[model samples]
Target: MASTPAPTSRRRTGATRERQSTHEGFLVHKSGRWIKISAALAAALILLYIFVPLPPHHFGSSWLGYTLGTVGALLILWLTALGMRKRAITPGRWSLKAWTSAHVWLGVLLIVIGTLHSGFAFGWNVHTLAWALMMIVIVSGIFGVTAYATLPRALSANRYDAEGAITEKQMVEALRSLDRQLHDAAQPLDRECAILVDHSLEQDPFTGSIINRLTGRYPGDATREAASELRRLRAHRPRVADDPLDKVDALLTRKEAMLARLRRHLRIKGWLQAWLYVHVPMTFALIAALSAHIVSVFFYW
Candidate 1:
């Protein structure tokens, strides 16, 4: 008699679904409550801007403009506080996750507040310069949010193989393993092929500029060139299964694939980090300009 199959398959599927459902990103934490709150705040500010009476030609010196400017300045300071908050790990209601969510949404709100405060009056002056710098900081922050949401999964997938997930250290070790095998395999080869193998071995996989890290383009990739050259050299010769050239060719091919994966990982990492370079510096510039704008206003008043 055929026995009924157990419910293990159904249980495993349910567990997987549960895990996926529970995974909460800071951007969407608590159904994006911070984002909703920020939206409401921005809407209220926009409506206030529309209804508030003002002179026919208004500048930031106007009452409503001063209010928005105050709000925007406070928001900028609070947003900057995240840089410090991130270093202090904590949990619960005021968790790092909650702070980050607030930071992102409130930062977005600054665009509306700042633009309204400017009264659409842009010039080559300190006030307009502050607004422009604020825009740069916001745009860079948006890029960072996008990268954080997406790149980790790509990085994880890049590190996985038939054997399972590997760490950054493992990736380096894999490359070293291939290099050692190639060295041993090519020991019996002639001068020309030996030089090719040595070239591949001598090249550092991690040696590249920021552009190379971003683009994943290695025009002088020694392993790739050596692999192609060895394959070409073997093409005209008789097929010999035990040839050291054949082994070296296989090892070199594997090394090329591994290096490609490692470079791709680096490129993804570079994207994840590149935004901070702009965000942090521009934030400081915005603060300086903001200080100048405030001083100029009160000084001239």
Candidate 2:
């Protein structure tokens, strides 16, 4: 009788699959029903603006203009309510996700409503100022949506390494470990090489301003400078198997690479947050302008 074949072990792919997230973000919520609804609403408003008869040389004082203005004003109030609605978490049909989805799509719809309400009559007045503020808010919101959709993946990819995903704390710990290793490795080197290592170690990876964070440009990166200088110093020197400078150079190169990754992460994160700095403040300005527009309209009437 033939001997029984050995049992084959199955390769577990669960860890690989578990690493990826399948979460549907708020923008794509409910198969983008809100997007469809908003598109339809915008289309209808445009048709009304085009087909509906208005008096010759008419302005925003027409009945259709008043209707669109009313709708636009109500939409603005509802859009603003999201700031408060987001604070309270609720489940089911009217969930925060649903509200966010509606907020985004309906906010886009405001562009059509607002433009038609303006009757294409732009001038340097409170009305035009209100429209300008609304456009600013809408554009900032568009940036926010794009950032939310794309930056998260970039952020996750930046955090991953051959050792898999790392936490913020782990990034700092790894840098510290590399620094300690560089310090130990530089001990046997001459004073010049030791100074290079010291310079690399003393540099802070997170010392850049907001502009540096956004641009990912650290002009004074000591680790990078040290690595370049060590490479040049080693160019003419004969290779030694146990050269202390070689180890320090290699460690400095690694520290520089790690700092680059951190800076890239910061850049992506800065973009993710920078829009809010404009969106929130501009929203308040839009509200104030809207209030003035409304008051001026009634005050003159």
User: How does each model score on TM-score?
Assistant: 0.89, 0.88
For model 1, residues 1-301, the per-residue Cα lDDT tens digits are 9865568888889999778646777887778989999999999988987887887576578888889999899989999999799899898777898999999999999999999999998888998999999999999999999999999999999989998888888889999999889988988999999998999999989888889999999889999899888889899889877888877877887888889988998999999999999999999999999999999989998
State the TM-score for model 2.
0.88
Quality of model 2 by C-alpha lDDT = 0.87
Give, for candidate 1, the lowest lDDT window spanning 10 residues: 52-61
RMSD of 2: 6.6
Q: Which candidate leads in TM-score?
A: 1
Worst lDDT 10-window in candidate 2 = 7-16
Per-residue lDDT tens digits for candidate 2, residues 1-301, read 9765443222235444434323566887877889899999989988987888886554578888888888999899899999899899997788888999999999999999999899998999999999999999999999999999899999999999888998667778889999999989989987887898899899888898999999999899888888888888889789988888778877888888888887787799899999999999999999899999999987987
lDDT of 1: 0.90
Point out where model 1 deviates above 4 Å.
1-22
lDDT of each: 0.90, 0.87
